[model samples]
Target chain A: SAVISQKPSRDICQRGTSLTIQCQVDSQVTMMFWYRQQPGQSLTLIATANQGSEATYESGFVIDKFPISRPNLTFSTLTVSNMSPEDSSIYLCSVEQTGGNNEQFFGPGTRLTVL
Target chain B: LAKTTQPISMDSYEGQEVNITCSHNNIATNDYITWYQQFPSQGPRFIIQGYKTKVTNEVASLFIPADRKSSTLSLPRVSLSDTAVYYCLVGGPPGAGSYQLTFGKGTKLSVIP
Candidate 1:
């Protein structure tokens, strides 16, 4: 497991605004994922970011809305574009480990509030 | 990913063992049962995972039956700090496959003091 950190742990934004959350892993990992957790709801996969490639987004999510960047193996960013009240949620990044149970370790998460 | 069904919520006392059962009858052969614990305002942390039989680590245990249709996550002598949302997930990138997972509504465990 690696130590993952997210910048701007939380933020308050107005409708139509955009916020970019940064995720930094202490060690390099092959798989980095971005997940969104709405209030009182389970986490949903937003996209998979692999270095040197475009992000692969899950259904109900698009690159235009949640743009992702994976410039290197240890860092990535997710930007919530044109935010709305319904976009208020917690954004987290996870890194898949190599050995053991192959568990995915997550960052503390960025709490976004769109008013 | 196999769809999972688990209790919405449960209440227990401190120092008591807690078991959360998740149903995944359609689980595929390659799918593994994994459990995650999420505290308020934080991302989920991996608890345990198993394919069959039982697996125990320092934090928790994962029990899977022969049918692979269901699994249980057992936490020993839970305390107030154990009160959190527990999620049961099924699936993983099967061998250079996709890096995606599906999460279902988890069981909320409230450990009372």
Candidate 2:
């Protein structure tokens, strides 16, 4: 089991503004992913953070809206730009452990509320 | 990626064994079946994973048939605290660069006293 943590456990931000969430892992991981969960909805993959390269965004997500950075293996950041009420959701960071199965471990999650 | 199908919700009594089945008819040969449990306002936690036959862990057991088209997650003697949304994912193991995990609606397991 990997120990994961996220900054700003819960935050209330104004609309049209932006918020950057941070994810930290105790051990180095091969791949890091960001997810968004709207109210009463399942988790949606936002992007895959690649170390030393550009992140891979999902189909519905775009780089202009959600930019990801993974400078190292243990840390990554996700920025939600031009936030709106629809963007109020739980954002999570997940990592696929080395030498482990396809199981992905997730952080505690950052709750973002846009007003 | 193989699309998964599962019940939207399931009701069970305390101390009863609950089995939630997930169907993935288009699963690939290299794809493995995995389950995760998620409580409200938290991240999903890995429960079990299996390729074929049955795999058991301290938390739960995964049962996959030889065809690999479907799998079952059995929770024995569930308690109220065990109520959560259970997710079934079918994908290959890591080391393939980036494999996005697509989660379905998931089965919301409710344990009633």
- DockQ of the candidate models in sequence: 0.56, 0.67
Which digits, one per residue and each the tens of the lDDT, describe model 2 over residues B2-82? 999999999999999999999999998888888999999889999988889999999888899999999999999999999
Q: Look at candidate 1 and give me any clashing residue pairs.
A: none
User: lDDT per residue, candidate 1, B1-113, as tens digits?
Assistant: 68999999999999999999999999887788889999998888888888899999999999898998999999999999999999998886334454337889999999999
Clashing pairs in 2: none
TM-scores, all candidates, are 0.95, 0.97
Worst 10 residues of 1 chain A by lDDT: A96-105
How well does candidate 2 score on lDDT at residue B104? 92
Residue by residue across A1-115, what tens digits does model 1's lDDT show? 6899998899999999999999999998888999999889999989989889999999899999999999998999999999999999999999986543557889999999999
Runs of candidate 1 exceeding 4 Å displacement: B93-100
TM-score of 2: 0.97
**lDDT of all predictions, in order shown?**
0.90, 0.92
